[model samples]
Target: MTSGGRRAVTVLSGFLGSGKTTLLRRYLAGHGAGVAVIINEFGAIGVDHHLVRMVEEQSVLLQGGCVCCTRREDLVRTLRDLLDQENSGKLPPISQVVIETSGIADPVPVLFTLGTDPVLQHQFAPAAVVVTLDALNAAAQIERQPEVRKQIIAADWVVVTKTDLAPFEAVSRCRMRVRQLNPTARITVSRLGDGSDALAPTRGAVRGLPPEAPAAPHSEVQSTALGFNAPLDWPAFGVWLGMLLQARGPDVLRIKGLLDIGDAGPVVMNVAQHVVHPPEHLAAWPADADGSYLVFITRGIDPARIADSLETFQRAGGRADLSVRELA
Candidate 1:
């Protein structure tokens, strides 16, 4: 264990079934001892812990469907344990920490907690928010899962996973979609989470003014989400979203909502730049609400124009099957 260098933490995140675990396993094999891993899994206790515990020297586990809402305290406790071990000489000084978040976990809260949490912030240095996207399933999942969209939008570096299985044509299309969602992210395509360099600064992890400040103001590009109380016709709303994405996906970083439409009591909707998936029907709203609610997040874009497009969608008769090209 080394004491002169600062400890780095990397958030390995992605949509469900993305190869995050495999990536961590690979990274750990290459790097020697003195690194700690914390794995968080969704629901019914994490199986990843039992499987990987044998391989790694030091590791902790947190299991729950939603870590942000329920198990935040667990993270603090585990981190403290690692630090204490480091101090006692029971373990080698931990040089780096890598957290594999549950598929549905939002990386923002994790990063914020890492920086703002008084106890941990003082001890650890922010490293990178590394996200893995399945070259085969990422586009469809991004469209169907709001959680997935947030993961991509919040990433500093994105690894296009499963590239070997995808043809160049398809991989190129996925990369294009990712660019529209995150214009500034460093993207690398990998078959097994391989990328150049061992260290990279994560987005949002670095706080404070840079050497050169941006010429534009924050208002020039703002992201906000709006919610709806009632559900509109699914077919009609689909048409509205279709037209909206086609017209402004480049400017719209993300969209997420749960709709109450017809028999689709609870429909999960997500949209990133060029990719769209059929709405996922969740178990039902928390209550028996009869209306649909929607939330949209956009940046450097005007909402009034989007409103006008929605109006046009309703006027032209809803076309649920509408599809369009990805906007640049």
Candidate 2:
């Protein structure tokens, strides 16, 4: 379950031939009991939805246009229909909802729909955006299609597919690019469709990295992780973060991390677009964890600018000793 009692929705996205269907089939075979699947395709007919329907009956198809683009309203209507079915006892109770976007789609619009639609927002919560990356072709794919960057930036987890087929150097390059593109996204590799567990929903996920000046924003978006060693003054840091998000929320795709606020337990922060989920405070830090870490996935913004602004605001607010570094 997510923050509230609402059912969670997971967005499955990837480039063409990135193994989204393989992972989805496996996920359904293992854990289809209370899940509703929606497959959107940009083809004339719904081949994948048909394939998925063979394994799971609780499935729907949105075809002919990209769900993240022209067919978004269809997505909204379909989601409402699913809820109506469950309400009328036409379908089993839905514990979760998963939407698989067309390989060419940009996930940001769908995320905006989820965060903005009042009816959907109340009934369904954002679980995670899980993206499949083809290790063999990821480096070239990123170079060829700019949309691929947005998919990675919006992802909460990236599953590197076809690692066995990819040479060690190819896989290595893919991993490096994934990290450089989305420093906070949890990445895992899989062969033969196993590792679907990484696609599952997580609660209050957080990660951070040491600071470094990134080259100019790669593509239209870029990501980096920022870490600070000292306990930050809550008000000072909060104000700085709030101002940044307020000013650039649209370009700031996602931000999440754990903060060390001295007296309090580690605090978990999450922000997507303009929406800031209530912060979660854990009882204690994990034994190996230390300091505060934040990951930022952004567009049209430089990591150095963000880091500089953060330090400036923090100092202006009188928290001078807070050390800030960007993850390499």
Candidate 3:
């Protein structure tokens, strides 16, 4: 929720066949209560919303143009309509809103619309950005499409789908590539019969993740996840992070991690380009999870260099070895 007590908004975006609708279906089935959903599809006929079993009355569809492109005003108007309806008691009070963008759409433009639109900004706050990546085709898709990079870079959480259909090596490479593009996004592999929690709105933190300039050099994106058993020095880490962002904002796409900040059980920090969302403290470490798990996604930047830099900044003396044989 925003400081004004407005409903939070979550944008679910990904490339075509990335299992976005599938994830949205599961999310609606489990957590649709008091939630308003906006679905956008590129094609003229919109069928994704029909797949959702409930909340037909609360669902709005924007078809033809992608929400981030030609139909942007429609999106703004639709959001306003939803707000007016709730205020007039025409529709049930919305505790939250989830927008599923057309597969081809870039989430950043839509994010700009929400953040800059005076009316919607006051009534709703951007809560999270969830992106789905197809394990079977992500490697090729990333190579062929620049939109994929922007989608991953703007993501708060990335769900890797269709792993069962792809070879283990292919899946590993795909996941690694995704991490490199958006270091801060929490990535989880999706398996058949996976639960709805994967798509549920992530609580805490409200900040925007803007895309990098279009002129970034052509290079393969890379990701590395590091684990630490001890608490991180927040002050030292802050200084290092500020310097890193200032120096290499374009090369660094995203950084998302759960940190053991001493007395606090765990705190989550998300950084995208130059923006750093306020860290959120979790109630406790996730089940069976120990210490901190930090993920970094970068283009033309080596994970080893980043690890070494952190060691230097924190004055930790020795460098920690990161086993890159598998995804974290």
CA lDDT, every model vs. true structure: 0.58, 0.73, 0.67
Candidate achieving the largest TM-score: 2
Writing each residue's lDDT as its tens digit, candidate 3 over 1-328 gives 4445878788888899888777776777677777777877633333344222121112123454233322257568788888888789978778778888878776755655666577876777678888889998898898889888888888877888887788889878876776556655667888752534655555523222222222333367766666554566778778888889878877776677777767646777776544565566766776645457667777788777887677666665232332221123
Error of 2 at 316 (Å): 3.4
Predicted structure with the largest lDDT when compared to the true one: 2
- For 88-164, candidate 1 gives per-residue lDDT tens digits of 98777777777778888777556555554577877875566778888898768877887877787766678888888
Clashes of each: 4, 5, 9
Given candidate 2, what's the lDDT at residue 184?
Answer: 65
TM-score of each: 0.55, 0.78, 0.66
Position 181, candidate 2: lDDT: 72
Error of model 1, residue 105, in angstroms: 0.8
